[model samples]
Target chain A: MKCNAETIGLMHKYLDGDITTEEEQQLKYHLEDCEACQEHFRELKRTLTLIQSAERFEAPANFTANVMKNLPTEKKQVKYLRWFKMHPMLTAAAVFFILMFTGVFFTWEQDNQLVVSKQENLIIEGDTVIVPEGEVVEGDLLVKNGNLIINGTVDGNVTLVNGKLIDDDPLDNRGLMASVGEINGEFESVDQTFDWILYKLKGFAKKVFSFE
Target chain B: MEQIIREKIILVKKGDQSAYEDLVSFYQNKIYQHCYRMLGNAHEAEDIAQEAFIRAYVNIHSFDEKRKFSSWLYRIATNLSIDRLRKRKPDYFLDAEVKGTDGLDMYSQLQSEGASLVEEVENNELQRYIHTKISELPPKYRSIIILRYLEEFSLKEISEILDIPIGTVKTRIHRGREALRKRLRHV
Candidate 1:
């Protein structure tokens, strides 16, 4: 077999002892007859051998130290970076500050005014004065002879009708009117035709003390 | 034997810099040689190898003791070398080509001294030529070749080091060696 570039290429496998016996025989036969191919094989082998036997150059005396010096004392930086990387809360806090600063700078000129209107305005002409759940009543809630159902929260005191002032909540103190023909009773409730007085002789005692 | 490596690894995890240094010293030569072959420059190879050790020391905490320490070290060294190679695009290919020419011409000048020159200058020229040819290869092929031929690591070790299948290592080594041979034909 004549040796060309392709056949010569197979000599690599031959030199590395990678080719099987049959290919080896074929390459050997080709090498025996061809001077150029044999020279090429010798040159290749010689080069590989030289490279293998060549004394490897060493790094300079201060090489390791120089590398260490250039390496940014990465121990401390890496420790800090790793700590920050592992601690998501710290990273989140940093990100939050950054975002806040960025947002303030970007939106500094935007209008952020908050307007508050007058809270309370109501009128009760007949049966129903309806208000939403959270609406606040600013002035006194006055009622005359009709039952008042307060669905919304009252901001001020409520006055009731018929001299029979009523309050369902135990925390409320229903102040009674003084006896002068001006709605006068001691916060009394007519319970089964009997009077239940809430604040009785306390005022009488106060009057006795004033007698001096 | 493997159990001893595991214990050393445990000590390393406990922040034993001496244990880590032992590990570094053990593999540093092979790693340096591998990097040197890959980078084709002594200074860069030393820097890369040292960096690899530092990284290995810091990240020893993350290593699985079940695996070979040498494999892990090789992986770090290989990665660092590849990264450095990527960042280094020769700013002057023309200048590099000129340098190559100058080297060949200098060797040829020494060749005028006859058969003795053949022993010294020819051998040096061939060795330098082999280095240049190998350096021309792509990083992947270059790595396998350097690890296989120059470092003379076992195919199994090379596979583990590069985190590749052995068959892939074999294929790359075959291709790379053949490529080097082909390129050096002109030398």
Candidate 2:
């Protein structure tokens, strides 16, 4: 290629030892007869040399000390987090135990529900028991559960072990009954004549026990 | 040496204050010089250099060990200097022509040390003139020129430091050289 201003600029790169050998040879051949380009190259080289040789400024002696002094304090929380990162399994195990204990504490009451099968003749042990309808229970009834549903007829005295007794007929007592736990919820009956008595009993129970 | 610096950086990341100080000491001069050239003011350069070290320390955990710490430090210093420069003079446009005696004023602001007395008097003016010309270039072009010529960073390293593509770095270097050459020809 013939010498031109752009070629001379490229020659500046050549002078800086930045160009490929082929490009360097091409520029050298072009500059062999190009006096103006050579002069421009010379001036560019001189300017680049001046820039390259400029002295670097040194930081003040206390720069590092000053920077350290001004640094924000190392956060204790971050140090703890770094420690946790280094022992991931330990962190995970701690988290797991915390969650496990919380789960057990929160669900302790709800997990106390008991289901009594119709075929069993034994006393069910739980906080709540469901006694299905159309069964005849002959023995003294004792419900230790927090809630009791007795649709069957009882031949002996009915006793609420730790909770309220719920019957369809509140006044048709074949025997007397007693409760040791708070009574909750309304009792609905099939017989309409006892409804007023049930209402009066429920109102009395509400006033007497503050049942919710 | 690089491995030692990397180990120190890891220590800094782990909250070793002494290690952080060592890292700052290693880079303070180089970063201060880079900021001084970019900002054209010694006081601002020192402030920016300190700020860069502080920022690097604060965000050291985010630094990837695979990259060069010097390049990362340079990037922080360059960004801080540019931000300060932009804030100091809201009306100063990098692409605007060098007007009035602002160029000479900037030349006067250039400071050098450790040069022999003979060389200082003779070459100081010429050196300041060239540095002033460089300072006249836009921050973007000025940075590429400084990284390429002064800091002697490779184009790839410049790309990584500035977070730009290598092609853009090459283009900026070319345009910066052309602008400098045009200004020098006038002188």
Candidate 3:
């Protein structure tokens, strides 16, 4: 309704072509009787024009060369930094695995002790036996608490009381009564042999290590 | 021109030093002028402009190709200039009112008839006087004025470069123009 400095300011915006239609109408209505505000708006426009037309300063002749010369040597380290930033989860997982493996490696001696003790028990039990091919046996063979595989020729009777007998030639019997192999003695199945041996080893280990 | 700049930027990212040099040469004057207008000192402008380019080079890999390279460079130069200004004038306040001179002084100065637009353009003194007055404004307002007028950045571009909201950019532009007009009314 009334004209003021703000009206003149709006008039400045209007001169800049930055005012909305409503503001334009308001400034036009105010300016119809406001000759002083009109002159102020004219001066503001001139000031803006003067500033916009100010000459820009030129850069120094060697500005680019100086910038290039002062640049830090491009460190390849930025590549790794960017990679880690890009794949944060992957980097964290890799770091975690590396730390875990390092911890395991550092404590490997203690773990090896436990493994060595278990291996000693297995050796004492002797549950697995290997027979190489092309070897010959001349005397009676007796195996207990183990599997006996025959890949070689045998000249004597074989008896397995607490183990399994595996022979490739089933009809190679020479002196004993056998359907698949020669046997001079009685063969018996000991189904509970492994359980029995494991129980005994547990008892022995508890005694040796004083485990509660 | 934009396509060529993008291609050169890609090469720079791949460690092509020559391409990097070309980019520096292309943008040196533009950046220098922006810094000079914002800073009002030739030596400081050159130093800060050089620093801005070096920083851009070091961080080139992180630059997104979707944005214009010139905008990015201007942003760097602006930020550097603002930092230098703040460090140099630790007590400067952007929102502080112009002291001592109420609206009357500006009105009186405006009334004292100065040279016409044609005469001011013909002479370099008016230009230098306007430049000095712009430099005398608070760094925040001066920066916006330079970006808007000298750099010819749009309101949205100024927002992006200054990392401010478009509303804030518009408000600052209005206030900055007002401040400059008050200062240049006498000249």
Cα lDDT tens digits, model 3, A1-212, are 34666895686467445899998888888778788777667667888788887866888898878887887665576557657978999999999768855654454333322111111112222454434455555565655556665554455555444456655455766433233333344444433545534544564578989955
The complex in candidate 2 yields a DockQ of: 0.33
- State the C-alpha lDDT per candidate: 0.62, 0.72, 0.71
Task: Say which candidate scores most in DockQ.
Answer: 2
Q: How much lDDT does candidate 2 score?
A: 0.72
Where is the poorest 10-residue window by lDDT in model 3 chain B? B104-113
lDDT measured at residue A142 in model 3 versus the true structure, 0 to 100: 50
Any idea what lDDT model 1 has? 0.62
Stretches off by above 4 angstroms in model 3 are: A12-18, A74-212, B89-123
**Per-candidate RMSD, Å:** 20.0, 15.9, 17.7
TM-score of 2: 0.56
List, in the given order, the native-contact fraction of each candidate.
0.16, 0.55, 0.67
Q: Report the Cα lDDT for residue B64, model 3.
A: 96
Q: What fraction of the true Cα-Cα contacts (under 8 Å, chains A to B) does candidate 3 also have?
A: 0.67
Tens-place lDDT per residue, model 1, B23-50, is 6555667778778878876556877888
Error of 3 at A34 (Å): 0.9
Q: What is the interface RMSD of each candidate, in Å?
A: 4.8, 2.7, 3.2
Tell me the DockQ of each model, to 2 decimals.
0.12, 0.33, 0.33
